[model samples]
Target: MTSLTVDRPTTFDVHSPATGTVVGTYPSHDELAVEAAVDRAHGAATWWRTAGFAERARRLDRWRAEITRGRDELADLVHAEMGKPRSDAKLEIVMALEHLKWAARHAEKVLGPRSVTPSLLTLNHACRVEYRPFGVVGVIGPWNYPVFTPLSSISFALAAGNTVVFKPSEYSTGVGVWLADAFARAVPEHPVLQVVTGGGDTGAALCRSRVGKIGFTGSTETGKRVLAACAQRLTPVLMECGGKDALIVDADADLRAAADAALWGGMSNAGQTCLGVERVYVHTDVYDAFLTELLDQTRELRAGSGDAKIGPITMPKQLEVIRRHIDDAIARGGRALLGGLDAIEGQFVQPTILVDVPEDSAAVTEETFGPTLVVTRVATMDEAVERVNDSDYGLGATVFARRHGQAIADRIESGGTSINAFVAHATIPTLPLGGVGASGFGRVHGPDGLREFTYAKATTRQRFPSPLALTTFTRSAAIDSAVDRLVSVLHGRIG
Candidate 1:
């Protein structure tokens, strides 16, 4: 919660989490600079939206190719700044590319004008609905999955014909710059995309600026501050916040597959994922076997410097938070099957799995953005489902069951639920992705994502004169009686 400070002014240094070396330096921007960038973005949006969906699609296709052509460079920036493994970084970019492709290819079909059936009372009129651009959008991205998170909003906004001003996390400003620079190369005519680098000050400024919409990806606490700041201008915001997602295993589940998913889901990306599995609920029938397999598979995973399957924690300060959570779990009578409090060392925190952790303990209740999971046993699937839904944060959940996977998934309160797997549902382009309750409101993927950046406008055209012109002031008592008779004739039950 402490604010970012600096002894050196004018610019800030981005330190590598894996090694304390300075990876990059970016200009420390201020409110004035943010206003200017938003102004330029809005000006470009004037011409960009007019280009229509086809022209925008062509430009976006070129942008997508540019990203693909230099994917290595982009992925490297992510690894260097965020300390995620190169392969993991690549997966993030590839997933983002899928979203970009979907936004571009399907924008016209989902957002273009489409006719709707006229009501029986107004049959003489024709109605059509279309979506329009929101002009300028400001995207404040996170350090983890830098390219993927911000691009989720930027790609959709651009495909819907809106210009963007992006402010990536201070930890990954270089990646943000690279993305904007690539956008410029694709469309050289306009400043359709711009980057302003700084800490929270710059982001707060963007929220208060004249942008029509703001898309933010970060913690739930930060999301509230952003929302309150945007309220000054009444600017609509899209918030993708924190989550304490749960993975459930049933009695008849595939034990091997469930173990693999539990380990990967809980420990991947150093457990700094919003949809990471923080809690596990397994039926007591297979609890011992499942835990044996989970711990056995987890032994192969390591979090340390160089060539490790998992990398260092991206944010340096999260080390203490992780340490405290592990300690609290132990103090509350939890047994560490894999790792204990001593697991945290500087930027690296080894994978830790706790058993019998109390439900009210901080480790089980809070978003421990670390490589940890709290596993517990339940008597039945109903108890598992009830326990998972108990969290205030419900962004996503994974259900692993042979006979009741879909049924279990249907009852969860998150935006996206994967059956027998964790996070693969996101790969499907048509599934709307977001969260419910404290996880966040509004969606950011599929048809809903394309429409999220635009406003809907409905049009009603006169196809012919209406027989009962009830809207006109020139109507007589006889016309009113005729309308009443027509309504009665259409709906009267012959009793």
Candidate 2:
């Protein structure tokens, strides 16, 4: 007779995807732990909300300085945890810091109480509206961008006067702890920002807990599950999900510039970016030239651990998905101008460029979050716009045209469109970033992002008595008639 036994680990190990070495180990927090973190956040939120914008801004500035001083250390940690190039990790930190600064500097003017004009019918009353914090917010982050994506939500929520209980991706648990520790160095008074490290169960606990709002970044399928779990508690959620983003190259577009942007946008971060360029639609007139340039640029790129142009895929399981997409594309008659299935070498996926890919193929329609790109030829600019708009994902799009750049960008169906550039919207602090359709909804940057964690508080006060008071119990018939006449006079003009 034989017997077998299995044991579950209470503390899970985080391994570097590039090296297959354990980088850090963290406790897998259960539901109760998540609830406790939320409780602590609630207490912190009360003080944080009352601290006034000036005080919060001061503290945030200190936090920024702390991060700046420790930028290299943090970037190294990010690289170790998620397998991104140190330089790329540093860039994410820089962008995230910029967003933090913008949120701190603009919070008061954006969310502070402001007077609004009273309606004619309510002329005797003064009206004002303000955005109030939602107390404690729960943020479930992603691994692809361990720092930037989560900080985009966390900074805005904090600036809007809410404390955040962050559940960082299990793959990036170490980086999440580093972020919390950095904030503590700046503001040690309260646990204004905290991290709970774990996997799906931990995130589910955060969602089910009594947080004011939730900000989630992941795949559309996982986002749907998060939304469903939040539904049980009726918790409001801001979803930042997946994207099958596209880049269009017009006939008059600069072949060199478009090719350069496309190569970087598609291959950076190993093409794991939610807004990364997965599909490139080029006008038939210049398709060959653009392809030539893109291939030349892509060929010079290499994927490896230290000092490589492209880093290894952060999630091991994602390698299989990438391979599946590549195989499916080749089977569907797509020709690989660059690397194909062979590009996915262990954890490292070398840059791949595929041409003649069908619009309905998985590589084009689904999100192949790897260093792979599928370029398709279009008959005209109109055809390019139609094909880009036909995707299930509408997160972002880019248009490259000399004369009709703006017009082409305006016609693309996406949450944001970049003209003659790739992902320029994400770099700007004032622009909101999110997606539409299967890409998910709710923005996480700009003014809209600040308000996503708060609710509008509207107030009205009587400045003086109304001559025709209509709400009095002792209203006379003559006064009612006068009110009716006023309403008719105010709104009776025929169109």
Candidate 3:
């Protein structure tokens, strides 16, 4: 990574949130630069689409291999730029690779032309449907899980035969550039994947550009802005906004397992995960026991730059939001079961657990996006389901009931749910990941993900003509009366 900041007007410095040191420098791409990138992508898309599924698969496999070979270097940059533990960074890379492979392997079957049975009215016609590339897609990614999240869209988009112009979060610009460069190494024929680095302005420019589609991952407010920009040209958009995800615990749930999963889900990556468990609704029957186990596991956990299990908050400004949530919870008569306001130390925030917090508090209502959890007790699983569904953001969720986990998971108004596991739905390559309602729309994995980047093209061909020629001018009156009698005979079965 280049540490020196070029004294140019179109460049900015990227600093490590944990160390407060300059990590790399990236260009502050403007509207013109973004437009140029999209233009290049259009040329790439033309060649890429003509490259046949087999050849595209071969190139995508090479790209995946290149990423695997350089995984360590990419992981290191992820850690340095986003402050996630090196292990977590590697894990994200691993997941991204799996999805990439899945996309490459399954794109043909998912998007290739397939014959469809026509309706009775068009029985003489042969109908078929196929998904075609949207030419160029603009992806605006988030900082958290920088490598995995963007690739979730980029990989699928490429496999669907579309070129991409990625605008990674300013905080993780180096990682984005690194991934794009790796793709270039594997597929040197054309610029199928490109990265545009900058802040909100560059992202807005990408949305307003002539790209075929936009894939955005950020806050709900930011997602709305992206939609508004894309709406200018009626450009299609796929959004994966952040969520205030919750975990439901029933009396039949494995208390020990739930505690362990909750602690990790709420603290890992400094709790920066959009699907991280920020609110947990536990059954009163086992609330005390569950709390005991959760606190016991949390005792050894710490957050810092060194060998701590949890890393520093990737974005410095998020510290204030975490602190304010904790303060508001405590002021509203919430009891701290673990760390509290004092747990927020400079750049690092130790895991904090607040119990008996009001459901309407900021800690529960808004997305904290930090290492904090608020556990609330409910009388029954019905209440738990109701409370979890009450949120405006319907993203991913977790259910810990051993006996009725799937039933409860089915009722939660979220995109994906993990039964007796945490964030498990996201790791599986066969499942589509996205949110409902304010959590944003569209998916980014599995078959749905592959189709999200492309448009459906339907074709019809006349196999044969109908025997009854009702259009003949000589016998039109007689044919019309005959057709009316046939319709009445076919429909007169009603008693």
User: How well does each candidate superpose onto the true structure, as a TM-score?
Assistant: 0.96, 0.97, 0.96
Clashing pairs in 1: none
TM-score, predicted candidate 2 vs. hidden true structure: 0.97
| Candidate 2 residue lDDT tens string, 139-202 | 9999999889999999999999999999999999988888888888888988899888789999
Poorly placed runs, candidate 2 (over 4 Å): 1-9
What order do you get sorting by lDDT, best first? 3, 2, 1
Which residues of candidate 3, in runs, are more than 4 Å off? Answer: 1-9, 468-475, 478-495
Error of 3 at 450 (Å): 0.5
Please give, for residues 437-477, the per-residue lDDT of candidate 3 as tens digits. 99999999999999999999999998898555654576577
Q: Could you tell me which 10 consecutive residues in candidate 1 have the lowest summed lDDT?
A: 1-10
Top candidate, metric TM-score = 2
lDDT, residue 73, candidate 3:
97
> Please, what are the lDDT tens digits per residue for candidate 1 over residues 270-340?
99999899999999999999999999899878998677889999887788888888898999899999888
Which lDDT values do the candidates have, in the order given?
Answer: 0.90, 0.90, 0.91
Count of clashing residue pairs in every prediction = 0, 0, 0
The local lDDT score (0 to 100) that residue 55 gets in candidate 2 is 92
- Cα lDDT of model 1 overall? 0.90
